[model samples]
Target: MSVAAPPPSETTIADSAQNPSMNDLVTEQLVSSGDAASFAPRTALALLHYDVASTILTDLTPNELLNFALTCRSICNVVIPRYIWAHIALTPKHPRLQVITLLRKIAFSVECGPHFIRHLEVASIHVKKPYLKCRNPWYLPYLFQELFTQMQNLRSLSIIHCDKMLPHLPRIPKAIVSLPHLRSLHLANFSYLALNLLDKLSGLQTISLASPTYNVHEFLSSTTSALQKILVNSRHTLEEIRLFEVCLNVDLIPSHHGSRADADTNQELCWPHVHTLELPQCIGDGWAPALHIAFPSVRTFASPEQSHWWTAALRDASFLTGLESLHTKSSVARGFTMAGYTTRRLVIGDDMPFDVTNTPLKDLLPRHLVNLQVSLWSSYFDPTLERFTTVLPMVTPHLKYFFMRMNRGFICNTYHNQLCDIVDDIRTLPLEYLCITWDVNCGKKRCDRCVRRSCPEPVAKYVERRLPSLQALTIRVDENRRWHWKKKKVEEDGVPAGTLSLMSPTREGDILREEYAKRIV
Candidate 1:
């Protein structure tokens, strides 16, 4: 069985109690160069590079630093010089500082070095200069142009505020076309890029665009050949997007100030090949027809907003066609209504009801779904059980893996009951993996359902009825169960028993929720 990759370790902020000096923190982080070799190639290079920078930037002024480090001429000569032979003469006073200056100089001089001088790769000035003035209008385009020039091999790129900068730049298509190795590109402000730039990134495998001004029709008109994944979050109407082989992220930003009628009409954006759809923070009703037509092949879908749009979208759409999964703000009520899709995977939010206006699970669901993911945010017990009950039978006949995350009270009020139901639901199929995750707020009203409960009788019943196909089961609970010594009685028994059972728990809240849905298939 293929297991999901575990999440990264938690970052603990250092306090005076932990360390006295910045140097002490540095010492705490000091990895022997030998241990550093085990890091990912990129990570190792970045760490060593930054370590060098930490030593060099200690004494330089901002402008002097710019002139010495990032300015184009400085980058070409002192940073990444064209001739290593000319570098021997220009040495700084400090030991490692002199070494960094030398390496940058040698890197610039190598043949084909400019093409390889990516931002994250070398000491490309594009990433360095931005901190000086990120919001200044001129800084945006200047940095982007430099980034475009420097990181020719960039696989992923993100511009957070494209709207403020895209309209101001002249359209230059060729520069984007020249980038060859780019695989993923995210433009939080796509409006800053010309339609030509979109046309040029034909080699991209994944793309996310967020723009309120640009017309999506422009993108549709460009090229559909090389693109595999696309995301559009635009207020403007978009048309003719052909995405049969891609995973797409499409979001609509709702405006309370804009023309209400126009806002209402703008929600019907289409995506033809998308398998994953996420609509968060959008305002509109047009999503129904838009999704119905655009993503006829979609298998995974989600929306953070609760509206009739979801119900309408699922009704006329082909539920049995190419879909395999569905995710939304409310899990039980909304999911039960659209159960006709026969999706292999289902992700439901806790706060939402399992009951909706139209459709029921037996009527809507296909009996072949294999995975069930339940998100917890609601604290009530019975309601959460109802949500689980709704999807259980609909999913049981084909389900294999059940993932229950009960860090927050909002998901299932009875964590033990939810686990019991999940085991019971998998009776008809091979229940292979059961993952129970917990968060930090355990013992509180919001987290009681996940912690206060014990492994109840139903849990053992399922164990006896044991689905043999169930080979892997992971139970993850939060590590941060703490008590205020001053406020509460301290006892050895009062300390939680299963703290040692906690490996690294998943941070369900921080997860890009859409990432969970799209992979449902």
Candidate 2:
């Protein structure tokens, strides 16, 4: 029986968390007192050259990178010279003093280190008072100003949960305008008054506004004018916008004394380069941008609800001529299908317990769809095996990319014939990339029937034989593990020849479903 390993214990977790970086392992001893830089040729860590190791180290967190640097002098030198802190993600859960210390180091660094930091994400930086002994009233403002002003070369900045930070660090708006290289900005939980810098900063490429915890009506109404001004100023350079729970009021900004528009009327503006837009669900909500704006180059559109566009360009155009993909819920997808709207790429992620529109796909799906992504996170009481039975066969055989996340009982582990039947259904797809993550219940189950027949390998083999154009296959049998099969070979490590890969709950994030969609505009 080939069984995956059980979950890790507390001691094993404590030991593994200390050495998290995937940088080439440092050779503790070069076997000589004077040759600390050299490694034995036979060592596995010796395989990666210095440049590759340095590049890989950039992926580590600030703390992890520092810990890895402490291993040896050679690695310490590498960390000091390179742009290892190009990306920094800070959350309230992180040690406050440690983060402040790192920020201070970057601000005063002699390596021009602050210039190398391209992306910064500060999430939920509000209301969590630090327990530090230094109780100076001006401490946060000074620290933030020093750190932010020195990051003049930053490319992307994401600041969320900062409604309280404004009271302490009001100079952040000025600091944002000081960056010449900044193009992407993400803000959440801020008032319209906080967005005055939007007019001062132009040439932005991406803007994402989210208000997860605020009143929708109040936030939207307050931010509409500021949002419109920013859009008009950055029209030439803006390429993507993602709005969550903050939709612009469809009416034009009521004339203010010295606003950008003239005398209660404005000229039409066109976003000639905007390629992707993700708006929140807009089903029965009564707000659509009333501005005379056009997104002529929008290639991908995602909204969770039905939409009614009143913009002159959208209303006049026969269809979204440039749109290649549509992402929405099952009910909205059905509405689009019923309205005769079709696209080559489609994504349906409806997390409803019972959706009547879900069955419409059983009878018809867009025949020309080249890429399909479906999320069946239905109730655990009801497995999506039935939906799979109906929809998988309907997908075009010529489709190239397919992604699905579903909860099916360990029927594959207990009933081989049912697994074979499921594989036979989707076998005709000439899929170049296929990803499936089977969502299992949290409860325990035991498969005592000598495990090879109870595992997913036989099903994968059956799939590989049935689909000739298959290029890459990834299957996550349970939450903790996934394996890839290519060229008739399965990358199953640390298990018997009969078993799949050992379940590494300690590894990293879920590898099953993150890569199915293209992100960049």
Candidate 3:
């Protein structure tokens, strides 16, 4: 007749749920007490089979693991290795100083170790508005060199730089190369000094050399030949390459498209495994032919922001012909339709190169598109509204995720009703996630569109009823406000319909724009 251990307290169970370190403590207590109780079929014994337990634990999300424990009366718990906390973590927000602090903690903290951090993004280094009350500006470079040295298990890394951070990047490169497991590397505002270091990295699957938001260092041109040289190290393993605007300030050669390079200046070097390629200014100055020859199997291609280049490229654009996904301005899509290119996923970012009234909007869309994101300036496209709406059902009948961004031009009457009609017309499709907004403020004189407006409760109920397969619907009538409906959340008690949802933003501002870029890539 051995005495039994008391059931674990609520505080202990909750702590174990959030803290992976506490998981072992909870399990050990239960085991010493000599009772399985409800504590998940003696998980400690299962942990003895290290490889099997590690594989199972790695696959389950914290929420999924918690749910599995609930089925066992929520009293018992699973043992998640404390070190895994580094991998399942929140990347601290932009302004890299905050990320530096998080790195300092994980680099030395007793519970969470550096080895678990497989991916790390030193998010931002905003020079204009530095948040320094005490720390010197030089602190960023020092922090990266120190903390990154400890994170040897790192599989992916990104360093996002602003105007001032470029000076500090020299010392940071050595620390980055220390990680043997590095697979992906993204360096925003990349300069030429780091060229030799990338060659040291092996087995890299993706490399992004992004341009700074402002063209501050326009003098140091990263030419097309340099781009080919960079890929020579990891061309076989690289699956994605984004050298957006890296060719900025290149010596321009005049052509039909301004700044278009007419000749193939660089030799073609193919990276057949790279299925995704993003070239903005890179296509200018004759980089297109070599790129076209190099990434022949690219399933996705983000055409240049210049519709003229996209239009010019379409003539010999064999790359565009085979793309499974396409991202460009509205005018580029019209050119795509004109050029006879098709893709399953289409993202038209609404940055028009010319007046959009010439082509029919519905005709521009590929009829078989499974996902579509389009941003439209309301006044620009108001002329074709009626005709486009009538044929949308026949066009995108297979759409699943549809995101529409509409900016209300000061002179133009609101297209709210017609926009909703576009949503209503596509009801028969199996559209799962739908977002419609009248919320883009382009920093010009304010429009009546920015004034606070909300749909009557009836409008939300109407769309929810019509789109039966729709799991999430987000509609923003006001710039700072929105309404969200999720199938599960809507059904819960105390969850009101048409509530003031937080940050259901369209892809407009700096933060959302970063997200927008990621979605297309």
Candidate 4:
């Protein structure tokens, strides 16, 4: 029997080796198959337990990071500790109950509630109802106190109160007064209670008070001592203060004759480190001297387009010595010559009419200006290329950035002619960047022609040919409500190569291509 079995040929053995049993095939498939749970452990996710993985996770969006953590238990352990819930914004558009419930859910996490939140903004929509008021003022203060109590790392807080609810809200709670890390506070349409909160926050570096409900003079009168205390405590840390539409009363400061008491009192209230002061139009002449005395180190001042504050500052040579930036209208710029003002940056509003013939751009701008922005309503009477040519030589020594915005209606052929001439003159300046935007309504009758002519190719070519120091140029033309924009970068050889272009109503690309071909021909 053994000899007969050994007689099995090589073919028979080979056939047996080529074929496998059904149980063996099923076992092999079971061993190789993997689900989400098995795949996650075998991938790079196992490395998440290391510190290096947290750095990569920090770049992911909040929702994306949360979804990733939900994939498996191992990933959740590593992601939860690395996630930072830094910014939280709540608006009235969201259901009140839903927002509150979500906030409560976040606060329930003991480890994240206090350590993660950094910036919090709460804004309510402005609703004008005849007889129904949905806002409960009592609920707002309680909610603020509860949230502030839980968020220990909050640095910036913005609260926009409803106009109808401002008068009924309670005083700022003690919870807000004791935040050690809070540096910025923005309060819009707030009541007198905000002053109490402000008094205790001496470590704040940036404070913006906008559209206060109470009279400015009365509010300052009640908190003069507290204000003095804050100045003494935060003088070194406070850098920026913005007051929008809130009047400043000079009478709040105790003025003494040239006696030791005056020196001692001034020393206690001086803000020696404040560099930026944004004033409202309500600030009067009396407030100017007080501001000069209080904030002697201020170098940048931002005011309304027509406020007389800049005029008052201009008269004080001592105050104007350190002034570096002026944000005002062109009308205001016209009254003051550039001879004495040391301002290096000027931002002019578009509402004013700048007559190049009358004002002469050379005289309107300071010699030391490094940045100039002229936002004007250009028309037939706007500045000409000759005026720019004349002025460029005078200011080119220091001017590095120029932004010109022309907002007009019905831009005719003359406008483009003037634009080409201006480009010819721009080639001579050592500008670092130039941005020109034309916002106009090209009638349907001329959209096709205007779109072709407004290619900005001529301007780009001019810059490439003449301007050697120019780095970047941006030109935007809006025709019949459609936007067309192009940006170019000047290479080391001084030729501007097209970097980016966007044309709406996508079919315009074909028209632009045809225009380019014709120009080449």
Candidate 5:
């Protein structure tokens, strides 16, 4: 006690030499007998009995689940569930023959038979190289029919990019028409087959057709009566229709007396339950006045292309007046006044010109907008950021979420002070969520000030000081150094107010840039 007992380390070693403890005896027994029970209880098996663990296993991908099942015997028993093999995708890049063989094996497996495939996608079909080759080119059709007939529970089907199958239009498989539970269908670049398929499926709730090679105007004219019958049959169940890079003629719609009469007397065909309509920008001007008449209940309208037709449609007094969400290019939105429009969410593309005068943000944006997403394609300069700041006060009162995505080479030369200033300006607004994403350039000649690791410090401090109402803030510097700032209202102090994590870099270039903003919170 007087000399601290020669320190605990030295005393412990001396005491151990005199008398070994229970731990030492157990180690000796384990080494001599090679028995696992001498150390600890078999608690790993207990994890399989937990509900939380089962929920986690359900979230794993198909390949990951397979790997986890093979890790040990106990996990394999818990991992083999029918829901894990419900969705199957077969693409062109991989060997289709091998994939089909595997699918056939899974379909007839004694343990998990038949009803395994609920959603099936045959994507990237290159007409040049059919999935199955033989002396008879029509063999693939029969094979597809057989596969579809076997999967009785198939509910969703997608066939895309089959341009080379135009010559085999009539020979396309018809098994899809007989699916009792098929609720959704997506077809692209297969005009004849798509029309034929639509004529057969009367219970579909969702239909998406894109860039059909057939002349839409001529086809509609020739099959106006059949199209009317299909529309009438699906009026009760159809809820969404997406048309991309194609124009629909309004005159072809069946009307009272089978003729176009005065607006007061003419009764247009209407889908009472349909609320979502996605139209291409190339839709004709004659279709503008008939939009609301045809879809009186439409609430969400999207223009997926960059064309002036959507702007023209918005100008019509008879166009859809109850739209709650709109997706359009910034260029098309210029010179349009959405003051009377009730749209609450707006998504603007990045292809707008840099000049703010051409596409005035404050004038074009609706006052009721609660969520705003803007894309910036400016590779070398970010002129839109400064212009957007000028209009923040106008949208500050109602806006709740703001998301901005910038393309490559956009933030390589930006300094910490610029980010701090932007955050300071944003703090004046009452935003609940904010997300900013840009590609980080790590080239050799990059600016030293820009590459400094403490770039996000000032921005984080500003949010902590100026924006007390902020709930969540996320900033990504490419695939690495993603900074997240979240407020925990229940905690008082000592806990970190924000967190910055460094993650491994992901895929490169345009594709990665598009996906960077979509990472989980």
Candidate 6:
């Protein structure tokens, strides 16, 4: 006798109801009966077992069950082109609701779904339809309206790339409009002349508009709504009232907002309540004046090509007051370290033009800086030893973690001493983590002068000194060797080439730990 498999959840009733052989019979019966959900659960479970045993599998895996449910309908209209639309043998009416229920259950689980929700969950469901890669161009509008209406708990709604017609006269369902959970609303690529649902959301906190043809006054006048933040991605017109939008003028021409052209002929623009701002590469010198004013209470700011932007933005007493963290694409932190400014953190990398040589450690650092991560590829690698020396005097007081890479550029040279000085100065501070990497691509003889040979000594000394506050020291070294028998035998023949002597010092982890134990003890 054979054993029977248990049934799937109620959400996937069809999967539990019909077999491939019985699809025609089931559909025929469902068509005749006029209702699929009203079918007996026992009948459904029997069909599912028959199909599982006869065709699909002897036993279903977790992925198979979830995929089966997803195909039944969670993300709809996601039909693959030029491929077969394989049916699940059971066709039920309102399959979408069942899929939604299954997804909701999965979302409530302790592990993955809940984790994704916690990270992605926000006050609203901001769907950038315009950014969505069109799966099927034919049913775009209908599919969008269906998905938008289904999100019953959505609060702040941001739907980008919605056609103007949809935005101009959004035909939102009565159920969606009445959702007490609904709050702020943002629309882009939606060219609606008027939105009737604007005032319905009484708990709106932020409203952002990013349409090519935006009428600021028209949007504001349309609703007598109260909001804490408003962002308009357009130079349509500026009201003397508070506004939040960072502008980048590629041609160095300030926006023409019709009010007082002659009031301040100096063209010194200023933003008031913007707490976070991003100045792209296109912005120029005219931005300096704006930075002095808008950055009073700014907490996080980023600028890619504009090194001067950081200098100008930080010089303001007000800008440095409430500042907590700063991010730049380029290494503007090369010459400077964040030691003096009140900001606590710094992130500099590829997105910005990181030129640390120009922005010395003194000018870049704020007073209370606690954590900083400079990009590994920044020019600082070659000149890091010197830069570290200059930065140590100021950063050592508050620096907690110094992360770096020991690649080709970082060799046993003058920079080695600078690293020692930095470690010595930071020994007294609560520096807890030091993550360093060394690339040992070639055998010791092939690239004997590689940087790895130089690092162990300093690392040994630092470890022997015993950084009491340090908790974890992770070092990843890549040993790469290219066969150079020709060079090894003929080139250095007189020097007794082809010898199997180890050029790079390899220290055992146990030895390092023992050394550490002695120093700490």
Prediction RMSDs, each to the true structure: 14.7, 10.7, 11.0, 15.6, 14.0, 16.0
Q: Candidate 2 or 4, higher TM-score?
A: 2
Model 4 over residues 1-521: C-alpha lDDT tens digits?
A: 00011112322221222212223322332343333454445235534334344455666654444334433323333343333342343332346454443333233222233222222321111111211133553444455445546655557767676333333343333545666777786766755654545565678788766676766566454555333344456667888877776545431233321224467766666677788877644444434444566778888777554455555556666656777776666656655556455577777764533334555765567776777777655455445333544555566467767777677634544445666666666666666666666664555575554633455565565664565665555565653333333344444234346543344454454354334222200
Number of clashes in every candidate structure? 26, 1, 2, 0, 0, 37
lDDT of 6: 0.40
lDDT of the structure predicted as candidate 2: 0.52
Question: How displaced is residue 61 in candidate 5, in Å?
Answer: 1.4
List where candidate 3 sits over 4 angstroms from the true fold.
1-144, 162-171, 194-199, 212-228, 248-268, 281-283, 290-292, 310-312, 315-318, 351-358, 379-387, 409-420, 428-430, 440-457, 478-480, 488-521
lDDT of 3 by residue, 482-520 (tens): 666555544235555444222323333324333433342
Q: After superposition, how far is residue 306 of candidate 6 from its true place, in Å?
A: 2.6
Better of 2 and 6 by lDDT: 2
Tens digits of per-residue lDDT for model 6 on 241-315?
Answer: 212232343212233321345645323333344455544443344355444343344566655465665565455
Model 5 lDDT, residue 193, Cα: 42
lDDT of 2 by residue, 1-521 (tens): 01112222322212222322322323322231244443332222323554455456555555454433433323343442332333344333546454444333333232323222222322111223322224454554575566566556677777765555543466777777776777888877765666655457778899877763444466554444566677767779999977766544431222121225453343335566878877765323444432223566788878635444322224323335456887876665665555555677878866432232336563334666777777654443333345453355564545677777665445334444544555566777666667766654333355454232234676567666776666556666565466665442443444334322323342321342344455211
How does each model score on TM-score? 0.48, 0.67, 0.61, 0.65, 0.66, 0.44
When sorted by TM-score, best at the front, the candidate numbers are: 2, 5, 4, 3, 1, 6
- Tell me the spans in candidate 4 whose CA falls farther than 4 Å from its real position: 1-86, 91-147, 162-173, 217-233, 250-261, 280-282, 290-292, 303-312, 331-339, 381-390, 409-420, 445-466, 474-521
Model 1 lDDT tens row, 1-521: 11111111322111101112223222222232233333343232222332353344344443343233222221221222212111123334455544344333322233224332324342111111112232355544554454346544455444444444344544323554566665554555344244334543454445454444544445545644122222233112222222221212232322221224553344333334445555444445343444444445555555545465555545544533555665545443344445544567766654333332242445433466677776544444454344644566554566666666654543335455555654565466655555555452344565434443443334433543545454334444454431111111233445442121112233332242224333443
Give the range where candidate 2 is weakest over 10 consecutive residues by summed lDDT.
Answer: 1-10
The model with the greatest TM-score is 2
Runs in model 5 deviating more than 4 A are 1-56, 66-86, 91-130, 133-147, 162-173, 217-221, 224-232, 250-259, 262-268, 304-320, 331-339, 353-360, 377-386, 407-415, 439-466, 476-521
Which residues of candidate 1, in runs, are more than 4 Å off?
Answer: 1-130, 134-148, 162-174, 177-183, 189-204, 210-275, 290-293, 303-306, 310-315, 318-320, 329-340, 350-366, 376-395, 407-429, 439-468, 478-521
